[model samples]
Target: MNYNGLFTHKLDALKEQGSYRHFLEVNKSAQHFPNFYYTNEEGVKRSAINWCSNDYLCMSTHEDVIAKLSFVSHRSGTGSSGTRNISGTTIYHRELENTLSNWHKKEAALLFNGAYQANTTTLKTLGKHIDNLVFISDECNHASIIEGIKSSGNEKRIFKHNDLIHLEEILQGINIDQPKIIVFESVYSMMGTIAPIKKIVALAKKYNALTYVDEVHAVGLYGNSGAGIVEQEHLEQEIDIVNGTLSKAIGVFGGYIAASNILIDFIRSFGTGFIFTTSLPPAVCAAATKSIQLIQRDDSLRKKFHENVLLLRKRMEENALPFSVNDSHITRIHIGNATQCKQLADDLLKIQGVYLQPINFPTVPIGNECLRIIVTSRHEPKHINHLVFSLKKLIYGDDTHNREIFSALSVADVENEA
Candidate 1:
């Protein structure tokens, strides 16, 4: 049997398809954020502006967060050493869970290694234990949610993205007696569109289905206290489970689920992903807890982030650059072709010193390949204008084919699709 030949052939196929991924190694200096050093294709180290970081508030570099991490690490050493059930759980983890539960106004919270594990394990556990369990999911739900639902080996239906009517139709056909769950993400990461949280929760109530909302993208950036979309919509009480990640806006590393005490206790007891994995380090948990506390008290960070979002959008519009026009902070420039998407990103990084990772297939639909730019509070007006200028020149340059593709997309249509 030529096992090596089979493996090589598949990898070769991916490279031939222009879908092969190559990660750009970067060293983000503590002194300068949004600006980092990366080696170009020619092996020359260069500085570039970051536009793809999920650290929305720049809290990952915040002094308070760093202080907590330093203090906890110095006091407790490094690793958590084992799964939570064994010796991993600590006061840091417990306190963080308490903070998270209170922030979301939930009865309890259970920490997971990360949001990926939380979603994957919790959904799988729920589907397995609940009789006649079925999952109704958003078409564009994050890969984690999709994976968890798939692992459950239960009946599942995917409705059109953000189409409440489609979701309701699917729900109505299911036998009312069967246990069901509606799983979705609060913010559609790729498109920057917010889910219809209130409407979806209302439907879940009408259909008597459990509601699970992954608020990974919305958690540190929305609501008065940064709870999430559910909080913003006043539907926090309506959502059965809310999943969030600390690695993003919270600007640390970990994930947790906020829910009723009974539901949380059930998942905590049975979720294999949580049960089997080593818990997050005490220092990381402590830092995350501090970050959350700081963010909840201050709106300046999110306000500054939104200002940057608006500035970038306005700059792109003024230049007539093609990008997804959504109300959310995510700025997606549609490039359509995978090769072109990578090329644009490479050129921006190497030549213009603008760094935004290209969004390609399986992260997004093939024809929808684009640059998912994330503007943070650190990006100034000059940086935004420079990005827009570089993008305009590169995209609208002598490449008539690329120009035609960009011209064909109506910004209005993009917004409507969102």
Candidate 2:
């Protein structure tokens, strides 16, 4: 067969397996919330209530943040034009780092373009310092960490998801004197489950290992002043390095690692991700600074966001929708097969005007297909009601719970059908 024919055959296989993805064009007015009206192929405008975005706090289009962005853009132009080690280190970059260090209660902070680079650089760089660097990572850690660990050429031990006993057992098996790093996330992005940070920190102490926490999802959304899981659990002192991002909660784009001054200095001098990449533009840094200030000064937004989460979760539970048990703003509704998950998302969008992108492998495992719904403070009660109604219609063909143990359906079951 011809090479093109073979490639086409592979594409057809993906479609048959329910893994082929297509992008939908949106051409309409934008809004503050993820939900917006978009023009379809026929130039027809339709309203879509988006549930797939990572904008947890709905600060992306805030007036204050936008104003700062505008002001900084006027002053600093469009881009940084050079790497941070060269000319990209602007006053805005310095200010953002200082603000972040203060927010997380760390001695120093270093900024990266995003969390992916932050994790990759930190993990890979740390691997070089220790004689024998051992990584104990959670099985469900983000792909960024996975790639970082892989590149480091270090011996990695993956613990079962949220299983303290397994994690402890692995630590116990490792040589106590070897330099070890326990890498994990405060709040997992896909699963929406929070790590047992306190317990993990305790284990780190017992094993004399460094605790590197990726608070990408939890930062600017948890704690009294949006410090993240370490602050929320009062384990800030215990955690050695706290990695976070400004894109999600702070309503901007960038990533940072907060730690002791010595550690920050070491990474700053050696980490290629930071040294080679151009620093974030002055406008983004300004917007992030303003956003952090807002999150710190105002507690009402956090409260409202939490309440919205509770309301949405309650509605889902009342409707007998299949979901995970982890407590956070992320509410994942499990739909067994990848095809069914995509179909459900598509049907809800077209029929009910509710929009959620279907999460399939390898973002998730093969069988654990889900529709991850993120609720924000800006979402009204009616939005939750519509989501519940649409989900009920799609999942059960009616609002009836005749299926047994919706949570028990394994990834294998879905994959087998596919």
Candidate 3:
């Protein structure tokens, strides 16, 4: 039936559209982070500065985090070996969940393979059991949340990104007694915009709707205790479901949902994504727990992380770089062309020894492709300056076309569109 030809045809189309995914192969020595060894196209291995790592505090590579991980691996070994219903639940698992619950001020917490699974499983389970359950989501919500809502096979409405008026309009149309959930991310990862949680919460209260917030990118980076945007906004108890990933700011591997005891139990009992799947490795969970503990114990890392964010933002502005206008750690340089986006990323890595993955279609719309530069506590000022210098050399020096496209994306208009 020429199945191979059919598969190739679709992949070929993606390549032509410059939307095909490409992964960078590199490894970072734990002690020396934001700097990693990557082989260039010429096969010569060179040290490169990392600009897009989700490890905001560099906790994953922290000596203490690694120490705990090693200690736990020696004590309990790796892999949980079974799903939670069977034998996967360990002391590490229980403690991490407990820590997460307390950190978010929720009555209970349930672990999932990743935040992706946590969202999909919980929403799908709720929809399956509740009658006339509908999901009202933000237009710019992460793919995981959207997939979760759609997988539930329930009616869904998407309000424009951060458009409280539109969200309220949708809520007003729904029956007062209907079971409704407003699903959104606390931090829109692409544009680095924050949701108006207070406004959203007020709307939810008025409409008798529950709030489900995905705090994957916010956890371990925001709030007094690093509980994420909800905690930062003092809306911890108000959010019905708070899904977070240990893989991001916590600098570990896994995801969990913090919620009321009844909701947690309900999802744990009926969520296929959580039930049948094997749990996270005990060592990883232990490491994640340790990382969070470290974060809560001190604000030094968070302070330094914000300092870097400010430095990067100031440099981008001083240089008149075309970037999204948002006061967040995420520094997005709007390039607006998929082909040029990939080319710019390629050039930066090959010519400048800086790694910033090209965020393209699906991750961001085609014309909205950008270089989502993320700053961490580990990034030095020299690295930041060099990154700006290299970007200027490639984007403004010789590439007139690149400059024109970026010039059109004025900071005001870019922020408005996003």
Q: Which lDDT tens digits does candidate 3 get at residues 1-418?
A: 9999999999999899899998889788787788999776688889989999999999988899999999999999878899997999999999999999999999999999898888888888888888889999998888888888888899999999999999999999999999999988888899899999999999999999999999998998899998888988899878899999999899999899999999999998899999999999999999999999999999899999999999988897788776777756788887777899998898888888989999999898778888999999999999899999988888787654556566566677766665
lDDT, candidates in the order shown:
0.89, 0.85, 0.89
Kindly report which residue stretches of model 1 are placed more than 4 angstroms away from their true locations once superposed: 398-404, 416-418
Q: Which digits, one per residue and each the tens of the lDDT, describe model 1 over residues 1-418?
A: 9999999998888777677889989888756998999877788889999899999999999999999999999999889998998999999999999999999999999999789999999999998998779999999999999999999999999999999989999999998888999999888899898898889988998988999999999998888998888888888788999999999999899898999999999999999998988999999999999999999999899889988998888888888776777767888877778888887788777768999898888898887888999999888898898889888877787853446656667777665544
TM-score of predicted structure 1: 0.97
On a 0 to 1 TM-score scale, where does candidate 2 land against the true structure?
A: 0.92
Q: Comparing 2 and 3 by TM-score, which wins?
A: 3
Per-residue lDDT of candidate 2, residues 127-170 (tens digit): 87766999999999999999989888999999998899999999
Which pairs of residues have clashing backbones in candidate 3? none
What lDDT is reached at residue 92 by model 3?
95
